[model samples]
Target chain A: MNSSLITTKTQRHKEKHYEVSAPSVTQWWSWFKDHHEDTKSTKKNDMSSDGNNFRSALVIGYGNTLRGDDAAGVRVAEELARRHPALRCLSVHQLTPELAHDIAEVDRVFFVDADAMADHVYAESVEQTPARSVRSHSLSPTSLLSLARDLYGHAPRQAHVIGIPAREFDLSEDLSPAARTGVAEAVECVGAMLERS
Target chain B: MTKTITISPVTRIEGHAKITIALQPNGDVAETRFHVNEFRGFEKFTEGRLMWEMPGITSRICGICPASHLVTSAKAGDDILAVEVPETAEKLRRMLTLAQWLQSHALSFFHLSSPDFLLGFDSDPATRNVFGLIGHDKELALKGIRLRKFGQEVIEILGGRKIHTPWTVPGGVRDPLTAENRDRMLAWIPEARQTVGIALETIKKVHAKYKNEITEFGNFRSLFVGLVSKDGALEYYDGFLRIMDGNGNTIADKLDPKKFEEYFGEAVESWSWLKFPYFKQFGYPDGMYRVGPLARVNICDFIETPEAEEERKVFKKLSGNVGVVNNSFYYHYARCIEMLFAVEKIEQLLNDPAILGTTIRSQASINRTEGVGFCEAPRGVLFHRYKVNKDGVIQQANLIIATAQNNIAMNRTVHQIAAHFIDGKKGKITEGMLNRVEAGIRCYDPCLSCSTHALGQMPLHVELFDANGSLLDSVTRS
Candidate 1:
């Protein structure tokens, strides 16, 4: 019969503050990093052939995994981590300037997430990613790349983003028929990235 | 030489809030400020809109739990109209709120909070995510997914869409619940029960394993606020305002929901657009309190709903229930107990059968007036007070978000957690300490995006200070 469900107090601004919780969750429990760090190490291993290669890849996913297809970016990063142990991957609910480190030292980066364009007609395929499908902030790949450049140095030679068109991004498990299909298609895109490297 | 700790682009949490902790040479917390680098202006943007448009527009603030915002906003509109909502409308609204609470809470605990508790806070950060948790505890992951799905199912059946539905309007709901939707929810009852069972078992096991966390983690205490039955029973969906002290006595009660301004006041921060809402009587900063499940349970005597009350008794046995849950870390435990409340409330509402009746929503419109609406949102108390012109266009709006209520209390709670956990510890600050701190904040489940919208290039700075306010270290979020 027991039930459970799930604060900041008001305060004045003080001096310098660093996030105390960042170290714990970010250091040991980084799934994207675990999945991609192996590849980064492998890429480092490949660096034995080209020790000077500054190329690195970062993939960040945004959207809720609990609700069917909104978890596109997270799913791809998880899958990428599983298949390729050497690529650097960072998965997050949304993009932030704090993520610049993940984007740093990488030659090319690809970001994935569910696209929510206010004007985008919910058309069915990857074949139709018009500017209309481009949504507002919650982290955008282009904006993140710009931030990375501003913080870390130069932009990577190649930077791109892959988006999944969501039809019914409800709290439901059942994805709109179209979004369900994007999952496989997205996996293939990651696989192609893996092969390209 | 400098020492720096960074978790670039933090992962595995809802919203874009991130933590960056830099320590001093002595390894003390130099300065700590939880940062929400993302700018979302739902509050400001919604201005000049019609009162009825709020439920739809503001629901867009949070994609994860729009239903709660939708319902709360609608309730505010109802207050403005001063029309009594049909009983069917009220019951349906309760069901939707409970349903969303179940889904949102599951996402936070099982998917977001579980990694630290289950995989060990010190586990390799790379693999300590939901994906890793999935491989480590596949059954648990599946149950979490299923449980959230059930809640979403309830939302979808009633609202037509889970993310942002227009089913709820100003006077009442847009339409009545159909037999088909009602039956669909009924069919999922068995699975829902099973999922709750899994959650109860897993949390209990977690409690046994990390009893220290439940007790010693983030021991900050403050006034707890929530809605409660006049009899002091826990009531989330609809009830009068209640604020209880540490001694569990009501400091403020039966305050008209519309007259919240008389009891509460808002203050602004130069650093962030988020406002700090404090108790008017107690004054600012010091008057800070926390809401959400832990606070809700702390303030109420018993849950009026049958099964929820029984669950409360058992939850109380865990570290004395609300009595034992003085620390913020226990918020996670308290959250699971709330899941039980949501489940129980849903069952009670559904069986009424009249909940599925033909009459739903009131049909009334306010010409223009100043009105206040209060509802115990899943997070805690959400107060939406608006002033509109003759045409029902909003002239001014004030929202006392549940997170803002705990603003000052959260900062103090951080101090509490840090002081207790790190007392006399040798060597460098361990990752566990960091996790514990984040866990404490997680207890309140602050949704920064929904909290405020400050724009125009935020300065990225997080500093940890010692007791005397000496800067230990500073890190920019950007």
Candidate 2:
């Protein structure tokens, strides 16, 4: 099978383009400034106002893009970012400790990741897991929430793990058929959750 | 019966690895080995790709220090193109390199190693982590996180994203630094400075507290290697190579980084996937030397930044007239000092108006078939060498990563800590003792991801085997 046929949207974005100009520093600064202000205002609203209306949401989709099927989470995040320009989305290789700061500032957060053991797309509430002396390169969603509350004294009132079923994880930019379907389902599920919230 | 104890997938480091200790019939420590079991084959797979694509592809080798690979790989491309990047491009690359040093060092000191210092080494396994540090000192934890974030933001300001940025290309960077972005980075200087200050003071307290660990944790005579400025000041972006003996003598100096292969040799062992790098003159095993923060600090004659220079004075005193700090445990101290220097250097670079110049790249085709790029990664010196055809497709690639260079030292460290903490006579090892062994490895901050081109998740699993190779006991932590 041709690898390009199975390439995910995320991989297309990552394709080598030597002629493409780098993003403008000025434009990025403007966006960053606006995002900072939005975060502060949303945080204040979450603290003072009734928790029901004007809630801010953050979607963190993390996995290895080069690994087949592991790119599902990032593909879902790219789709969400395209569909809802107002929503804040982050696609990362892995979850790290610094992510807690983002998790603490929002009212709700969805941690999207590819799960090798899962059979289908699903979302489950994430509980704070007790700290353990594990590797620091990557963190589980539960441990990250625990870190948010412990360090910043704040965690999203609602947190969840959106697991996209994955099988192949070989060194390739393509996604498995199952993962491609899972990405779509996960994106729809997260969109519905964001709207209801 | 004799037995073997294995600590697989060592925790708090960048990649997957294990340590095995063989015991004599009397239960005395006989031999120890550090094994890197996983392999991603980046060197092998990168072949046949265009030289221009290398900067992006190689940067994915390790998530913890992608910028290091990105910058070094770009330097290799510069060599192939035979073009001197514009002045502004050089400065921009320097800024990005320092930002990476700041963030990577912060991650090493605060998130990974601090728990061992702030919380007791004997602390419960479930609570001896960054989360535990937060419960103990919220202010410190927040400062660490923010400091790291500040560095990441600088990278984002320069490149488009925080991780895996392809903004750096062959011959030069993709963009110039804008005034607004430069000012935003400058605003972070004060807090970054303060956090590094507090961290330095805290590490001193840790040094005073663990006097025994200071002496026994990988403390021995070995050569130290790193990059040094023309006048022998601390350097990260670019410089010639320098190798210093453990007794504070400069054995080799003013050697071109491009000729690194002439001085250093890589030796492979059957038990591990990671190669052992040694000084050529001294030979293998016996030629073993240390790299990274400890080596960088020992090698340079001085640091240009005022605050860091002052700390370097204090750091040198740790050697007490011998001149070179040999203890692997002091890697944390050296790392904090380097962070201070990185912040100071970043501020200086940002103040230069030349950083805003428009001429950032020099376009060229493959003028050279083989090119070697070398730079000081956060951990230590990193080299990226490539051989390409006239059409620019890579024929061969070699990556001498910092972690692989310290492989022999890490194994020695594991043995030293194991021997000191574990009394084989008792025939049992406590979790604390095991953690101390891991802590010794953490001092080097080995990124097996870079060393082995790592794959898969790393969870620590220690197993014990009797003389007949029968499993006696085991412990696993996820």
Candidate 3:
């Protein structure tokens, strides 16, 4: 939704396929650092800051694994678990209400999901949204954060969404080549974010 | 002049559905139809796949009740293999099934339907949700979330993942219950029990408050169908098919699930993708029966657990002389009772020493060309039938989904609520009135995704049209 923060592109494969170029790790880190500082300066009361240090972090990567590139989020979480065993990572089909408790216990949280309409992987800070009607079984990341604050009276000091660009969402377990590449980039970006935190 | 009120993409349920209410010249409801709009050809597409891959593949049919599909598919595979699953494996499978029931029912009650009861049905559509529940009673909301999480945790411990785990296999489960995981499950029992108990009390108050709505919301005399143990006790995992009439008479007992097609028939409607399943003896609409929590509690003679059995006694009294609770709104009440039973049953299963046994799976080649597996899913009775070749490649697959089994009844429920709430003469409808109609469908907690095997976005759009088919009034909610 934030066009300025997102960089979109179009690419052609065997068939003309629209693609989003992934932001380099350095560019992503720079954006995140600036956004982090902006949040601290603008909303001091909102962040339970421990002098810019987060004690614990949780990564919830959720999407339908059975769907094609929709599995990008879960694949990223699974890869993160395999690569960084010490990190607390959960790969679920969708975000449900119970995840609020998990989110409340952490100082920082990253919600990774596949962005079907996006051309490239993008990360943005998340803010708690007012709860509207729950139209479906699944909850959005902002809604989950709201639930965490409303039900548990505790929310992560920092929350962000790392969306992997995904196109194919048909009934298949394999990710698209573009999505696979996006997953790699997203994972590296999240890993760097974790290190910086 | 005739009028039609269409509610598209019915909200708060698992999948995409629409309800159309036809109003007669006198402003009376003429007919109501619940139309499931999406279709996933799981039955047809499953052909040519090896029998062993079914549990994993069919499990993907729904995120809400994947465990039910997983377990039922495995049972079908077991029949193809013609090998009796190990005793420990059966116990583990039972635990997983109960866990599925707990979580799925909790979601249906607390997250989906509770807003209608806890907050008045006429409350603001924006605030009438789980979020509203959190604002109104934070502790209750927390308990509901934790209760559902407890069920998912038990499932994760058994199947290795919360959703769509392929741990249950053809002969048995893929893993045994380790003591460590068993301990984790045991630690959750007390809180889970307390939450269910609290929910039960809350539903009782809701029942008392909405006495008039209860009788009008799918309150009809049709046959109730579910699986009952050999001794006529409540059963979920494996049992004989039991069909009880509205008068509480057992019309059919000890029916073999393998011969489900002979006794049960599926009728198709041009309007909806969901099939209407009926009792073959009664035929078509006359044979209309309800399944799911309302039907399950009605058909079962007794529950094995102590606390749940006590609640079942009070639940039965709601039917008065008829001896069956026909009011579908009581589906919420029955769901709470079942959750209590699931928690107690989970504890009982955990305490069983044989549950920890190591011999989980049995290996075997194809022994039969056809197999049928039936179980009581969280929604209702789920049947998976498969036909295979000598090499065990699937040739045909037919699934009798629980939601589809209640198609006729859901339509009837929509009609009943529409007639009671909406007035065609006024040419106007309130949001509360429309919500009551949708709430009737929610009683069944119909999983359109599992029934139709298709998942899509859900939003509510209501359109009112005159006999000439010109739009008169419309309301949209997304």
DockQ (Cα-based) for each candidate? 0.03, 0.23, 0.31
My TM-score estimates for the predictions, one after another, are 0.68, 0.89, 0.90
All candidates in order of TM-score, best leading:
3, 2, 1
List RMSD in Å for every model shown. Answer: 15.5, 9.7, 6.1
Candidate 1 lDDT tens digits, B1-478: 2233433223333445545444455655544445554555445655688998888766656655678777888877887788888889888888888887888788777767788788887786555655466558766766776677688778877886434546887777877888777777888777777777677777778878876766666565567777887787787767787887655557888666667788777877664445777888888876777788888777778886676677677766654533634667667767777887787778778888788677776777684487666677667788777788877888888777776677666656555565556522243345566656666666677766542111112333344444344555454433
| Per-candidate clash tally | 53, 0, 2
Candidate 2 per-residue lDDT, tens place, B1-478, comes to 5779998878888666888988876777889899988676778878999999898888877777788888999999999999999999999989889888888888888888998899999988777888788778878888998998988898888887745757888889998888888889989999998999999999999999999888889998889999999999998989888999989999999899989899999998999989999998999888898989999988999999999999999999999989899999999999999999999999999998999998999999999999988788888899999999999999999999999899889988888888888776555657888889889999998887643111234556788776666777789886
Fraction of native contacts under 8 Å reproduced by each candidate: 0.00, 0.41, 0.46
lDDT winner between candidates 1 and 2: 2
Q: Which stretches of candidate 1 lie over 4 Å from their true place?
A: A1-197, B1-11, B18-26, B38-40, B318-324, B420-430, B450-478
Model 3 CAPRI quality: acceptable
Give the Å shift of residue A28 in candidate 2: 38
Error of 1 at A191 (Å): 22
> Chain A TM-scores, all candidates?
0.58, 0.71, 0.74
Report the number of the highest-lDDT candidate.
3
* Segments in model 2 whose C-alpha atoms lie over 4 Å from true places: A1-55, A129-133, B450-458, B467-470
